[model samples]
Target: MNIDPQKPLLQLNVGEFLDLLKNSATEKKYEYGLKGLAKMLGCSRSKASVIKSTGILDEAIVQNGNLIIIDKDKALQLLAQNKK
Candidate 1:
């Protein structure tokens, strides 16, 4: 994954995002926090939050009393399905 610093990260469609995550996972871990997920999806935190609020995505885990985590693969699938 060679990302050129001078260029913008490609805004991936849902399928591409899922494939990228599948190829990048180690030990099958594909979860990310809201901030990290926004980065992965090439969107802002508020946008991600809105998407989540619309029931297109859900928290995959919650830990340490306040941390919320999402499954990237699942979110991508839901987003893709929602578009259909």
Candidate 2:
């Protein structure tokens, strides 16, 4: 059987996209530790240490037991703000 080229593709709004991402493996894949956050932000480890000291990353970063995770969306927003 052949498929129609004009068939519409699936669509998702911003909220739906966020929800789907939250429910998907993308959450874990996107989350980062302080080291990973530094890498993603294109900053040095010392800079990350300074950020940690400032506590701005406190709300953006989460510590679950020994696992340190940076909130993906929050981290992206923080990166954008720092670029300005």
Candidate 3:
């Protein structure tokens, strides 16, 4: 997958993110922290909840309520458009 060097992060709306997850190649279990994810996303917990509740993000794995790791490649691809 080619990523544009100029762009940094992909600004995805709720639907786009969900589509990416639905079309992911790997179905293996993944994990990550919600708080950490919120920090990484630069958004609040509320926002994350909204996205999840709306089915924008598929939450198949959540351990101890802190840790979320999905198909990294799929996520990157979804956001990769920004760089392009």
Best by lDDT: 2
Q: Report the C-alpha lDDT of model 1 over 7-42, residue by residue, as the tens digit.
A: 534766566667668877886446556687677678
The candidate with the higher lDDT, 1 or 3, is 1
Candidates 2 and 3, the one with greater TM-score: 2
Whole-model lDDT values for every prediction? 0.66, 0.67, 0.51
- Name every residue pair that clashes in candidate 2: none
**Runs of candidate 3 exceeding 4 Å displacement:** 1-31, 59-73, 76-84
- Over 4 Å off, model 2: 1-29, 79-84
**What are the per-residue Cα lDDT tens digits for candidate 3 across 1-84?**
333346434766566557656766665433255654465457797875554454344433334454565443454344444453
| Best-to-worst TM-score order | 1, 2, 3
RMSD after CA superposition, every candidate: 13.5, 9.4, 16.6
Of 2 and 3, the candidate ahead on lDDT is 2
- Candidate no. 2 TM-score: 0.51
How close is every model to the real structure, measured as TM-score? 0.53, 0.51, 0.36
Root-mean-square deviation of Cα positions for candidate 1 versus the true structure, in angstroms: 13.5
Return the lDDT, model 2, position 50.
81
